[model samples]
Target: MSDALDRRRLLGRALAFGALSVLPGCNYDNLQHPDFADRALRAMSRWNDRVQAALFDPHTLAPTFPASAITRPPRFNAFYDEAHVHVVDGASWQLELFGNIAEKRPWRLADLRAAPQESQITRLICVEGWRVIGQWGGVPLGWFLRRIGADTKARYVSFRCADGYYESIDMPSALHPQTLLALDFLGKPLTPPFGYPLRLRIPTKLGFKNPKSLVALGVTNVFPGGYWVAQGYNWFSGS
Candidate 1:
């Protein structure tokens, strides 16, 4: 929590330094469709997100203890999906993929499991400055991207969620070796509230971008605003 707060403070300082003030009196929304102020804010937020990644470069990780060092019970911040049923019940769940090279397709859990898998028992460092060591078991996101033949025209990948939340990232983050669509934990199926069937785990980014109850994956060249971004929060939320 303190860490997230610190980042918030840093963001304020950055914005002040940049002299990117909200328009006075004149409503940005009323000025034009999509609005210049809104676009400027989004760009500033994306730039701010790079701060954390620059802070932590782990060609060699920091001196932290092993998994056994984690306290008995992990802290839960309750950022799980506030929408959608606890269980997907199979039949209705969908992971729709749309990209430039291929027609759209919907995939379910079974289809996900059938793809190539990658497991990494590494750190999950939340924006709140807390860290957890857990083994993520699931198919690599690259597997899906490859299946859909993500194209050169697509520079970003967006996660559309059933939770009324959305998140996005550039090709570099999406293709990071550790990125996964985690579906299991501690050798068992993920609990209902812990992004059950799958969630994007981009370890280098803050947990906020980890979209739960994922509904669709859209590949696009333009960067779209995320749920938090639309609500006056940084779209990148990285680190």
Candidate 2:
């Protein structure tokens, strides 16, 4: 096999082993120490991220499903419990833009609604092992980036959420045609549990990378590590 294929196969094995280590009855405690096994796992995760990044194609689109395949009442996930979910007021919510952008302003929901909208039915694969397909509608993220005069050369696009959730994506994924600033779900305004007003729908990434209830976005050369990333989840997290 070619070197690239070999690397890909190795990454698959690393990922599978990592997954198995967390299953029920596994000796997770023994593996948690700062020993060779732990270090090796971390190294493999980083290597897998690099491999996925090098193989990523900006023009590639994730598979889409029909309306019948859409999951009803998409699952809710957050760093905190459901009771502690951030409830944003639609009338007062504004999206803040900062870092490497010519125009830094707070955008109201009406501003997003006025832009051209796109819709897609895509699957959200969670690291926790469940998947959901949902129909989302929103403005194309790339178009919004251009409209706001974002620095195209910046390396990362980062988000800050009302629920203390933060995440970042590489610039290539940020510019993907399927990436969206999602505003509606199931053909209606999004509910609080579903990230009302605005959420990111990045089909290229794992579910957590698509943060909900976003308050601000930053474009920068510096890497803005995510909530789960700092807690040892993979930084790239491409699906």
Native RMSD of candidate 2 (Å): 8.5
Q: What is the lDDT of residue 188 in candidate 1?
A: 68
Q: Write the per-residue lDDT of candidate 1 for residues 80-115, one digit (tens) a residue.
A: 423544565546787888656475768888888888
Could you tell me which 10 consecutive residues in candidate 2 have the lowest summed lDDT? 4-13
lDDT agreement of model 2 with the native: 0.85
Off by over 4 Å in 1: 1-43, 49-74, 78-86, 101-103
lDDT of 2 by residue, 40-99 (tens): 677988899889899899978999999999997678887656887789998999999999
Could you give me the TM-score of model 1 versus the true structure? 0.71
Give the TM-score comparing model 2 with the true structure, all chains together. 0.83
- lDDT (C-alpha, whole model) for all candidates: 0.65, 0.85
